[model samples]
Target: MAVHRSRRWSFGGLALLVSAGLASAVLINTSDAATNRANAATVTTTTTFSDDFDGAAGSAPDSAKWSLETGGSGNGNHELEYYTNSTSNAALDGKGDLVVTARKNTDSGLQCWYGTCQYTSARLNTAKTFTQKYGHFESRIKVPKGQGVWPAFWMLGDDLGSVGWPGSGEIDVMENVGYEPGTVHGTIHGPGYSGAGGLGAAYTLPNGTSFADDFHTFAVDWSPSAITWSVDGQTYETRTPADAGSNKWVFDHPFDIILNFAVGGDWPGNPDSSTSFPQTMTVDYVHVTTSDSGSTSGSTGGSTGGTTRTGAIKGIGGMCVDVAGGSSDDGTPIQLHNCTGNDAQKWTLGSDGTVRALGKCLDVKAASHDDGAVVQLYTCNGTSAQQWTYTSAKDLTNTGADKCLDAKDNSSADGTRLQIWTCSGNANQKWTVG
Candidate 1:
């Protein structure tokens, strides 16, 4: 099990940095902070793995699917729980759920990093049974409530034994500390962006309803180009290589799953007088679906399904549609530049009806419908602003604005910014969908 850290995070483009032990985060770029959440339907997928915890009450999880990780070293997060393989710590409920409990017990005579063990809990993992590259990975869970209680569903790259953390990479699909009962986080950690500096975002329940009150779905749609996080089907954030600043994106390999209920970690602090013990995190199921080809199908409401086209999009003066500086950061200008065959000049026409490069979508600025609106590379939100239609005539049009992608001022020279204008079938608006 990989012990992770947390810190400053975001929701859309809003900045909210929180510190957890030695971790903290900084704002790197803009995201599509839409008031309305994305409800776009997804493409087809094939079930790859599933577990419903449907064994007899008090029974352990199927040995074929899970391995109990026993320890009291705090897993590097300063956690207070001494993990055990006993049924008292982890068992399947007759009601079709797996319950991992944390209890305030000293009878085990366990030794922790702080001396005597104060609590006992369970950490279950699929490290030996399963590993996958890219797809939709999800879990439905009901967390425990009380200060110092932490529940998380996450993954670590299978290369941990060789490359180690932040190098092997980690993805937190859902994580919650007791202090924030209505909120859960989704984060990713990699080189140059680990610990408190990890990039992530928060999703809070409306009307302040606690997650402990019911089961909720937390998931991430992962592909070679981007990772999108959603809570109960509502998309709250998406991260691409651009969001990593200048750091390398290390999520292109296989990873294994982890589920744990911790107590008194560095992020949640020590359990206090008001805290309750014997807290249990109930998991309804863990399900994963993948694209047969090893990458996720394009997002919803764009192209139905087709082979991805990657190359340069040639326009007037034979210049290519390029991302400024080859940066994946949101708001990076989409312009016409001399074909250098570099990553900046590379564009992918996805089956999702979006044009992309550097892990971002070609977006219409602010979802604007007005002519002369700037076009840039932003997070893929499956919104009309990010959807494009490539016609047989080689015209790249924004579906929402219904405008042709135009070269500003009809200039063919390099560094010409691209914009959306009323369709005119002019040479500047014509493009080759590479």
Candidate 2:
């Protein structure tokens, strides 16, 4: 039996509201933004890597890049024994591939942070080791069987600590449980209703065969405009920011990858008595690739260099109107006023790449400069504040100092704010070219 603790993090909700507010205000007139630019530049095609990992040795194991999460103790109906370089739980190599096995512990002696659970398992990640901005990510995996078992290959923004969990963004390339053997899910999570509120689509394997029975290639083709999920080479689901309202879309940033097998939780539910113990998730290898010439496509349109608008500001709410100038400055209280085509509301994209509006350059709030600061327009200083770089590959980079435009606090609310921060190389910083 495992005991779980539930604590409400109000700050997360507040941050989301702020983020929504900001996005709404700045993103208004999305159509106008779209009309401003011409067609984008053509994309050059290139392959980043094609790996088989069939070598007898010198192959990269989960160990080189993954770390486990332990002590979950059945919290959220979870069944895995937490493996944190401590006692009972550990990751091992089974033959040629990496294996994460879950076992039942007979002894009631071990205690977990939440309470008690008689199980152990492994969860792995590439937090500090490596991360990809945009590319085709694929993995050959063999899932475990029995109810309550939840297996997943996913990605999260690398800036977890600074920006927090869902705020940083989550991408579930593949997720399946024992009960739903033939169905796999792909989803994205951000501020508003992340975690339990994650939004996604699902695919059912053909021939009545469950993914648990064989090694299947689970992959995601991630680009600026859309993200498509596939099994083997078959695409099952696709999501685009344009499809959903802008508030629900945040896949434009960089995200780190993760693989894990959990026992149960709010979504998968706990396993029953018939559930088997000592289940395993075998991973053959993971591969990542990007185009060489730097061109990609999707709903957001390609980068052409002429004025091209990919997305736009929809509506502004709760913005202070009486503020002095629209110049980009630190701590400027941004307000929502009627669109006057004035410099304040007229955000301009300079050929030099700066986002200027209201006589000010788009500025990071005081450069508090932390991961979650709000974004505001300030007077142009030609400092990093006014320098922007557009990539033919469909991402916007802050050439000013390698920094990137960020949503304040990573919130997904209607009035959340925006700001500039040091680039964590996450998808949130990745902007589509159009």
Candidate 3:
């Protein structure tokens, strides 16, 4: 599992690695990717939470805003680093930075739950400390780079323990792999779109500028209906219900913030000969604001200039998808009715993981992915059942079940119910959206 390139790694136990030819040990060069992105956003001064990390070097992070999460249970990604609460792994640098370091564990007798420890890092969260439903969440940081390095600033639902991952929802504000020193990613994950399949996009520095060379702000402006992702204030992506296809949207609840640095896992794979030890991800600040000063109107709009894709989800028999009777009810049967070019068939796919119609979303009932699980029109909540991916093959598959959105019995009738079924490459399971 010694991959050497840039690619996403899921939290489950699978691995995929590719090498994009990163210059080894390149001296840090300055860039304005962060400054430009930041100047593009209008974050309000009304603060709901903030930490400048002004503590003296060697001290722990503020206990009121962050709790150190320890252990190395692979975090469900089959990661290779032991997470620790030790000051050596995470502590404020005298220079006003929260340094989360990944190092080669030197204690010979020390072992992880699985085997002898080789690496150690840190994970910090605001689990029971501070959870919020919406607003602006931002952080300024300089990330480290090297093969197998995985650094992220993200959030999870406060009910994570009870609901578990995808059901609890995950929002990745910023994540950078060491092999891709010039790029960073932001994504949202639920039961369906967790791991590498989570809906997201990468922001690459212009002219091959390395993001690891300088500090930049990563952020998301979240509302009841949509989420807008940005880098340094430059809005690059926005997601809504329609973007999730037939998956459920499950992000309306409160969530906790998390920051972690991982090494040698599924996506980035294991570090090899060129990899270095004792890497650090430095954070200068973390802030949250409840202000609406930077929001866009309507159920799907944002100021960050993120991509907004709108089209029709045309399925079998050349019919367009629709909400039966164009109703707004929760269980309105999704059908393959005639294309009337009305709002009932209008779908807006967004950077956020949602597929929206009539301002509602296409969702899998109860988040089920069974062969016959029903699809319906429902209010968006950022759940997995509502997450959709329009693959190159034109198949509409649910992230949760990995099943194709199918026409019941291959029927072309106006009121045929849509369901998830085994993807057999049949006409009934293929779809087209522009």
Candidate 4:
């Protein structure tokens, strides 16, 4: 087993070692556009729950949640051998994280159709098992160092089986290698530019540190109007359907997640003589979250001036409130109030981790808080009551109970107090703002 590289690496000579070619091009355009695709017929299924590799003991991924894809002819680049389901390639422990190890192994029984193949590794996905239309998708990962070591956390359309690649669309959440240690790329691939001509962008971290050294969170927030990529919590790049040419707007469809570590490929070129073997991409965890249509209303704030609201708070001070009424519990309906010190006015914005508010952290009471449960302000401790989540539809639920914040009798009138009630599929539970 190779020691995981989780600290940033040195990149002092990157400027001289690599030429600035087409990779530095930044195509700038201006247009406010969004895709108006009919919502895909989604099944109302129970959400899957799993550990996020953040606990005491780290474990393997859930076998039921992932499927390994092996065999590689070196797509575009002459690379190493395929990763079979053997000891030297892949393994899953069901704890929510997957480890894909690459090493020089001759008897691994895996062979690639391309150049001097001598290694095995892994590629995993949640294709047929689970797919989401719109939400936040993120992965905490540490990539391997060395030229030609290509590791990517990306997504492809779930309908790829029928529609095929490119036409189904591709979303590269993170792609990094040893050569460009401090820089990572995020791109979307569709019909016209699917393979190499696709539209994308690259972000370089502060000079001196490379991603291979530390575990960084790569994420994308997909919504109706636009898509934005971020490192940790900072925005890097954003794209809208209008920015894509007519045939390239395949992002309207649902996409499944994929995590893979590839050796030498056409893009990254081949590993040089100085390259080291046994490179590995260690994943901390992967999380997916979705919102109901119009659950919360607010704008996504970032360094960019364009503010498009898509449920989640894109930046600090992003708030969603019901200024017209109070709660059925006789409490005031939570409003997107300013960051005041008041308990009822404060809100803890989370990407996928957890929620915090006031001096105490909010949790889902009993870890089963369902529909209509009174969402009260509690201590900042990590408890169930403070764990309230608003889906794309804006239905707020405490994970500890079965109650939800329900509009009293589904009233649209002013002052319609939000009360705790049984989980009922009604307009009262439906919130649409973003």
**TM-score of every candidate relative to the true structure:** 0.61, 0.54, 0.59, 0.58
Q: Which one wins by TM-score: 2 or 3?
A: 3
| Superposed Cα deviation of residue 415, candidate 1 (Å) | 42
lDDT of 2 by residue, 1-434 (tens): 01121211122121221100001001111222112111112222233323333433333344445555545544333344554343234334535666667777665766654566566776656554555555667788999988888788887665555676566767778888678888888777776646545567777876798888899877776655566666654445566676556565666555666777776665666678988788888878776544332343222222212222322222223221212254444557543344344434544344324454433455555544355555565665546545554443323434433445544454334334555566544444444321
Q: Ten consecutive residues with minimal summed lDDT in candidate 2? A: 17-26
List, in order, the clash count of every candidate structure.
3, 56, 43, 65
Off by over 4 Å in 4: 1-60, 92-97, 292-434
For candidate 4, the TM-score is 0.58
lDDT of 2 at 389: 46
Taking every candidate in turn, the Cα RMSD to the unseen true structure, in Å, is 13.2, 19.0, 19.2, 13.6
Return the lDDT, model 4, position 359: 25
lDDT by residue (tens digit), candidate 4, 1-434: 11112211111111111000001001112221111101211211112222264432333445566656656555434555475555456553345445677877666344468544577887766664655555566778888888878898887765555666666677788888668888888877777765556667887877578998888888776665567776764455677888775665877655667777877655666678877877778787786643332221111111111122322221112333332222223222343333233333333333332333322333433444344443443333445454444444444444345355566655655434445566455656654332
Q: In angstroms, give how far residue 59 of model 4 lies from its true place.
A: 8.0
Tens-digit lDDT track for model 3 on 1-434?
12222222233212111100000100111333233223213222245567899978899999887777666667666678887889999999988899999999887665664687789998887764666666567788999888989899887765555665566677788888878889888787776766667888888887789878899878776765567676754456677767777887877666667888989877777788898889999999987654322332211222221233456778888899888997877889998988898868877653334576755778999998689999998976768787665455666666666677899999988888999886677899878774
Question: Order of candidates by TM-score, top first?
Answer: 1, 3, 4, 2
Q: Which ranges in model 2 have alpha carbons more than 4 Å from their true place? A: 1-62, 73-80, 86-94, 106-109, 295-434
lDDT of 1 by residue, 125-166 (tens): 776777666656778999999899999988877667666666
Worst 10 residues of 1 by lDDT: 18-27
